[model samples]
Target: MSIRSVITTADEQVPFAAVKERIVQAMCAAGLGAVLLFGAGFSSMETLHNAAHDSRHSAGFPCH
Candidate 1:
């Protein structure tokens, strides 16, 4: 059998919408986890910018 015919013959039991929903839920969970971990001192733009600058410097790509 050809590749397309073989693939078409395989069972497709799962719906596309269900797969998309699961992916969205996973992404939301990951975003929430990141917020909980790194949202403590990110109350202001200046603080966030400074933290990013310091990180870049530490990583040897200084923006000074």
Candidate 2:
């Protein structure tokens, strides 16, 4: 067998448009996940702040 016959060739080619579309979809999914995580964190922080405020008020301490 010849040296050229021993080398394997790539049989598939990816189009630029398909690659771009896949990248855009991945970016949008990541952005949506980040937004949802941020919103959940903000809601937890707000709940904590309200609980602390209520505790302080019940203890007769001025939080302002």
Q: Could you estimate the TM-score for every candidate?
A: 0.43, 0.52
**What is the per-residue lDDT of model 2 for residues 3-63, given as tens digits with 9 covering 90 to 100?**
7677756865668999999999999999999997786677877787888899999999999
- Candidate 2 clash pair list: none
Which residue pairs clash in candidate 1? none
Model 1, 1-64: lDDT tens digits are 7887557444666589998999999999999999967785556878778888999999999597
Whole-model lDDT values for every prediction? 0.82, 0.86
TM-score (C-alpha) between model 2 and the true structure? 0.52
Clashes of each: 0, 0
Candidate 2 has an lDDT of: 0.86
